[model samples]
Target: MQTVIFDLDGTLADTSGDLIAAANACFQALGHGEVLDPLADALTAFHGGRAMLTLGFERLGVDTSDVVDREFPNLLVHYEQGIDRHTVLYPGAIDAVERLRANGYAVGICTNKPEGLAELLLMRLGIRDLFGSLIGADTLPTRKPDVAPYAASVERAGGVVGKSLIIGDTVTDLNTARAAGVPCILVGFGPEGSGVARLNPDALLDHYDGLDQIVARLIGHPVLV
Candidate 1:
């Protein structure tokens, strides 16, 4: 079956509010003062947790690596508490996944989020069963920017590397897909801010609605959303 793999954070959902809350909680608990600006969340469409932490510390005129070792778990705990506080599906994401599956494409998720949390979010969003398989950071010893997860997801979808497409909002996703020798699609509206053009995916998508057209081109039959 044709396969489509998606990244969780920026590609499928807008998780910045929860992420920012967690960052603030970490700073507040440490008496580091509130550091992250709301815009930092927008910028995070590219980088994940570490990037956001680095940016927060930079804004606070502090060195992040020094505290990251201690603060990482705290931040994760804080973030998890509010995981669903404001997370939302990017526009057309649901339609895209549904239509792709209806068209006989095996859809899966390959994300760096921890497996349990990713599954929680998808289930909370009521899209858990839409995917044929889900791969998360903890699913294996290796994570994205490494090909293992992508290869595994493709295999779970009953396909090989050459027959799959990886969709995500960051360069990490593109890098992983490239590592696995698969075509990549970047979601323009996700975290990367404005430099997504440089990632050089096979296509840059602004909305999930546009995805059906892309799938149509791939399968030679229009996908119904």
Candidate 2:
């Protein structure tokens, strides 16, 4: 079967708010007081905890590497505790995934997030059972932009790599799909907005409502309107 692999953060959901909150928590612990802004630093949040910490340290005129390494664990702890507080699935995301499944496509997640954290977030959102497989940063020896994890995610979801496609929000996901020799569909609603088109994916998804058609077209599957 064909697969539609999704990148968790910034793709299926807007996780930047909670991510920034977690990073800010670390700064607060050190008397820095919320160095990261939820609105201004959203893109950095999607880049991951380390990136957020580094940005915070830079803004505070401190050594970023040492602080990032030292407080990374604390950031994760705070993140896991309130992962879904401000996180929410993009509009029509769940419905689109369900439609894809009903149309005979295997849907799964291949994220750079830690496996346990991804599972926890999905479970909290009440959508863990929706995916056939979920491959996280540590699930395999390597992560995205490396074809290994991407292929693993597809196979684990009972899909053929040749017929699979990836739907994501960043260049990382685009590169991963390219490395795996599969089509990629980048979400236009992400932090980068329609500017993601510059990356030249197989397609740009403007909204989840059009995902089924986009997936079918890219993967060579037919869907009856």
Candidate 3:
């Protein structure tokens, strides 16, 4: 089956607000009182908890490595508790996925988030059933930009690696697709906004509504609708 693998954080949803809040909770416990800004630090949040913590520590002139290692677990606890507080699915994301599935495609997620957290977020969002498989940061020995997890995700989704494409929002995803010899579509509406275009993916997705057309064109399948 042909497959469309999506990146969870910025590709399918805007998880930055909640991610930043969790990182802020870590700083708040240390009396730092919210060192990262939601709007300004959103990109860092999508990068991962460690990146956010490192950025906050840098802003406070502290040794980032030690604090990050110590507070990383706390950040994950906070994030798991309130993961959906400010997270929202990108508009039409579900509809787009449904369209693809109805048109004979298998859909799945491959994220840099830990597997447990990714499952929790998808379950809480009530969209866990949409994906045939989910490969996360720790789901395998390595993560994105490496071909292992990507290939695993595709195979688990019942897709041939040679017939798959990735939908993502970062250079990590782009590099992963390139390494796997597959096409990638980067979202223009992610935390990096239209600047994601600079990565020059096989296609740019400004909205989920255009996904069918883009996927069809790149994968050489006819759009069902």
Candidate 4:
């Protein structure tokens, strides 16, 4: 079976809303005025929590260490509280996963996000069972753009490097695939820390619907219906 490994955030789901709200909650706890809209904040920090916190503190002229100490925990707490409240599966993502599974493709997730939180988000999205394996940041001592995580995900999914595909939204994702020597597909709607176009992945997908064709082209097999 063709194995498709996915990145959790930005690729399969839009988690910016929840993340933004969590950051705002942290700011509120710190007694700092709200600096940005929750959704906008999440989008801006699509990279991760540290990136968001750094941006927030930089905007407020606060020390990074201070912000990390006082606000980071609050942010995590808020996120844990409503982790799934506004998070959403990207359009056509569920359909694509289901189609891939139905076509006998083994699906797995390899993400830098914490394992516990990633699992929670997937379960909340009602797509947890769709994946055969999930390798999160905490799953190993290191994460992407390290190749070990991808290699581990493939191993867990019962796939080989030549038979697996990595799908993500950032250059980091493509770099991870390169390090793993595996094929990769890029999502146009995801983070794109620099620019999605600059990454030059194996394929560019405008929507999750485009994933099916991209997979067909890469694996030379009908992995999507």
Q: Which stretches of candidate 1 lie over 4 Å from their true place?
A: 218-225
lDDT computed for candidate 1: 0.80
Identify the superior model by lDDT, candidate 2 or candidate 4.
2
Q: Tell me the tens digit of each residue's lDDT in model 3 across 1-225.
A: 788999999999999999999999998998888899999999999999999999999999998757789999999999999999999999999999999988988899999999999999999999999999999999999999999999999999988888899999999999999999999999999999999988889999998999999888877663344
Which regions of candidate 2 fall more than 4 Å away from where they truly are? 222-225
Rank order (by TM-score, best first): 2, 3, 4, 1
Ranking by lDDT: 2, 3, 4, 1
Query: TM-score for model 1?
Result: 0.91
Could you estimate the TM-score for every candidate? 0.91, 0.97, 0.97, 0.92
Give lDDT: candidate 1, residue 63. 73
RMSD of 4: 2.4
Candidate 2 versus the native: TM-score? 0.97
Which segments of model 3 are wrong by more than 4 Å?
222-225
Model 1: per-residue Cα lDDT over 1-225, one tens digit each: 578888988888988777877878888997877677655566662365777777787888787767776888888898778788878888878988888877778889998998988888888888999887899998999999899999888888776677788888887888997788777888888666457878678888877888977755543452335
Deviation in angstroms for 32 in model 1? Answer: 3.5
**What residue runs in model 4 are displaced by over 4 Å at the alpha carbon?**
191-194, 222-225
Supply the TM-score for candidate 3. Answer: 0.97
- Cα error, residue 99 of model 4, in Å, equals 0.9
Clashes within 3 Å, all models in order = 3, 0, 0, 0
